[model samples]
Target: MRDAKTLFDRLGGKDSIEAVVTEFYHRMLADESVAHHFEDTDIAAQRAHQTQFLSAVAGGPVEYSGSDMETAHKGMGITDAEFDATADHLDAALREFDVPKKERTDVLAAVASYREDIVEADSTDN
Candidate 1:
């Protein structure tokens, strides 16, 4: 009988996730559209928190100890464009590690679900 592998296992576990987070942040820092968000932030601590969050999203054994998405991003004025840019960077980082398309899609989909919480609706949209 074959056992099912969790996304975490398929994603190469904590080490791979950590590497991906590091790469993701590097890409984010290079993206001018969203880079300003981290200008005053601690990259090391942010990476650690993101690593934990992604691990939990991937079904890893670790639980995320960070703030809730809405609470964490509240009042940041995160627009849709900025949110998309961040997602794009994450996609690029996963591709950098040669993560398979299916896995990449799955990971992106999981994070995309939080868009409502992370993105503030533009007042002009109304």
Candidate 2:
């Protein structure tokens, strides 16, 4: 099986990852529902971390030592619908970057594999 690093390198490494993420966030910020989720976030920092995380997952040179996925997304009250929207946005961004369809599928698959780690029920006791 191809490792994360090999896949990432084949996909153009850090520069490609950064471009895709920047595009993704730009789309997110333009969408009202997505924008609301990031209202309290430092978008610059979030973008940086996203790039790092993707880089590591794609098998680039970076090691993502950031918070665990659940903790990172916790307390955001993200619903299943919102998660689907976010994933769709990411897919759009990848397409905009002209990523080949097969490569896009691979990348999306890598991302989907992490869904359980990043999503949880709303913690409020309501």
Top-scoring candidate (TM-score)? 1
List, residue by residue over 20-45, the lDDT tens digit for candidate 2: 99999999999986689888889989
Q: Please provide, for model 1 over 36-90, each residue's C-alpha lDDT reduced to its tens digit, 9 standing for 90 to 100.
A: 9899999999999999999999888998888999999998889888888899999
What would the TM-scores of all predictions be?
0.94, 0.87
Error of 2 at 41 (Å): 1.3
Looking at candidate 1, what is the lDDT of residue 15?
97
Each prediction's RMSD over C-alphas, in Å, is 2.1, 3.3
TM-score: model 2 vs. ground truth: 0.87
- lDDT at 50, model 1: 96
